[model samples]
Target: MDRSSQCDEPSSPAESPSPPAAHGENEKNAQFLTGLRLYGVLIGTSVASFLISLDTSVISTAIPSITTQFHSTPDITWYASAYPLTLCSLQPLSGKLTTIFSPRWTYQTFFIIFLLGSLLCGVAPNSSTFILGRAVAGAGGRLSLYSFGTILGPIMGGALTEKVGWRWCFYINLPAGAVTVATLFLFFHPPQKKPATPLTPREKLLQLDLLGCVLFTASIVMVLLALQWGGNQHPWNSPLIIALFTGFSITIIAFTIWEQRQGDSAMIPLSVLLRRSVLFSVLFASLLLSSFVIPVYYLPEWFQIVLGATPLQSGIYMLPSVISQLLGAIFSGVLAKRIPYYNPWFFLGSSLLCIASGLYTTFTVFSTPPAKWISFQILQGLGCGLAAQMPLLTVQATLITSPAQIPLGISLVLFAQYFGSSLAQSIGGAIFQNILASQLEQEAGLDKTQIQELLRAGNAKVRETVAESFPQSLNAVLEAYNMSIFRVFWFPVTGSAVAFILAGGIEWVDLRDMASSEGSENRVVDEFSKPGAKQGGSRAGV
Candidate 1:
């Protein structure tokens, strides 16, 4: 085994070392952090994860305040979509950068970027600047606390919005991020594997595949722009919309071709992506996330606009879903660890989510019972939590034999998740805005100017104004909002159904056996320093 051969191609199963030899190699390769340092590192990473989750979930409740202050309802989608746009677009580049550079320094750099973006958002004077800040923050964001931060984000966002202002939502990250950065700098020291061959800085830069990143990012921007503008800011058949879609198609095709040609050096390696488990994982994750993200973004709006709840009230109202989701995730993890298969959980979760989404369409401006809405939230949350992490687990298990490919595999799945979220939010926003505008005009007799005014006035102002001025149309206005939100809910229903169907395609493996045998020769750590280490391998058996 020599370094040159290791870089050339992946080794086959027959070339793997024996179990005893592998155990010895694993011992030699393992890096352990003990005592206070280990605990410090764990706390640091957990706080960082919490910050990411907070950034993601905190904005939902504060969106109405932001829109009101900026008086730009048209830019609501951008507020939600912008962050995910850059997050997904630059995800691969971040991964490549970490591999090429020191992980600690790279992490610090990203943290600094995120902090700066947060500052920009906190001090933003307009919608455009705020959206730009979100995009910048997203480019540096990648981490989560599973469900704990999710449970607190809305509550904290609402409290800050009511007591201080919506700007505090971004400002809140500053102190927290500073502490997290300090903790990580002092305590976290990850083991880095040197490359098989030393390369110049130019060579390392080239490995980032900036062209592929540009093409992929361009393709995403084109489609998002089309979604944002079509039938909202511009006519669906307008030249700009048509051109955007056309560009997306062409750029995506070019990205695919380029990626194929690049082979292992590609941002998303075809050698890992084409596997049955990994491909299914990517699709399942994307669709499942779409189903989950729609409710996370829109449910607060439903509470605020349709039901006339304040921001703080809406955050409290979201507790059922968030708490249930956390419970479901913990339950699912426990069951999956004990069970031999995870496909059943996926099927069950998707079924619950599909049912919940369908049920959400039945909500109206009046006469919906608390028990019904509460139960619906629980069902949707439980469904999302149960299935959300299975795809990652599946990918990791499948790629255990090809350790070097694990990170790449995980990154692709995550990219799909974020990309799906961005696309879904844009589509959902478009659906809600377009339908609400049309329905308000037809049913409530509100003109475009009045509608814009009503949107800018905030929920409380809108209620007072409508009751005082258009008393007879107040019910109609609320109904229009309800109908529009219900229509948006249908997208999640479709997404959940598609995920249910895709669950059949996910190849199953006995995780129990895999865990038990992980220390054996089959579970090789494909280190770059090793001469004969396998970079990729055949798909894990079903």
Candidate 2:
């Protein structure tokens, strides 16, 4: 596909091999990374992913604290949604800026912005201030990390809850962001990105699309708010939710049309989505990845409620998956460089996830063993390791023909990521709720006596009658909740199956194929690197 015309064209230099070589250790690392052909963008993005994942996951633990602090649930979801909404909204822009502004500067600037937002969130005096801080933190949160990994390297995703606690998830970005900035500045100096030629002031001014930016933000905001509120706050049929949806829909439509009319200056080009491969990749990516919502949020909840573990212990249970994920991502990158192929890995990843989820579904209160749970998670992690970054490999490979398309491709990946998580969260929540409702009804099987008791409790406004039914209701709700949650794995399983099937159609494009045809090539390496390869050290970032 002609990704350049199809998507927002990045202004960066062609992503070629041979980084002009760095000094001593840098040179060795560079060679190794190049040999594995590491994506520098991935290193920066891994850091970003750590921060963003932490922001999303750590909050569940802190919610009780937040509730105590704020004295209400009035805007609980607001705290979490602020960052994702911003990340989703700014994704298209951020993905491009990495190429337009030099990935170095784009990352540095956004990491700082993220850090500042984190600081404000950590020190927030009240819920409103904290939410505002999260909003600011969110702007670059999703934008920085999501595709930088794909554009440059295999970045690992994770939360910050382990070391600093829930608040630290936001606060932890301070030092981590600083360390990331320092690492890039000190060790990684990208080639100077001079424009092809100097542009006239008018030409440069004309290139800037202020209206496009405004429209993009407006569209994302409306869509996110509508999603957050609809079926949760107001009924799905409410006017406000309806209005927001319509406004966002129209805005997006107008933006698409306007971009086509503007031609080269369009924020997002129409051609990107037009390509079957690009379009299908995005769809499959979203569909398969949507299943991650269960692991991200509910895993901790499960540990807390079902196994009766502390937040920290729950975080520990996740350590295996998270660590394995890091290993899997790096291994895939290294493998891709050492050998070449993507289709099998993609399918394997989806299959593993499906099987893993299916395994988790077997968990039971009295019948199950502890080892069974861990064993299933291990298999799931193995699959996760395989497929997680392989999609990016294809996406990046697909865009190699048009370096300009890299930014939009990366942005789409990030946008798809959080958007998938958010959508899955909502859908999964509803699924869990319905299961809980039905299970509770069946368990209680309330009779006329219970109904009379309920009426008496309500009419008399007495606590006694209500108390009688509450326990039964609560038990039913909890049991159903567990069932629904464990079942959430099926989402990714089903989505993954389709993704796996669709991936069989991807042309076995190799990195070596792109580099040179006449020069000597690692034909063997090309054949072997199906999933990906490890770039440098097995360095764990998050």
Q: lDDT of each structure?
A: 0.76, 0.54
C-alpha RMSD values across all candidates: 6.7, 8.8
What does the lDDT read for residue 80 in candidate 1? 86
Model 1 superposed RMSD (Cα) = 6.7
Top lDDT: which candidate number? Answer: 1
Model 1, 211: alpha-carbon shift in Å? 1.5
The TM-scores, one per candidate, come to 0.88, 0.69
Stretches of model 2 off by over 4 angstroms after superposition: 1-81, 95-108, 124-131, 142-165, 175-217, 262-265, 337-340, 365-368, 399-411, 429-474, 508-542
Relative to the unseen true structure, what is the C-alpha lDDT of residue 104 in candidate 2, on a scale of 0 to 100?
A: 58
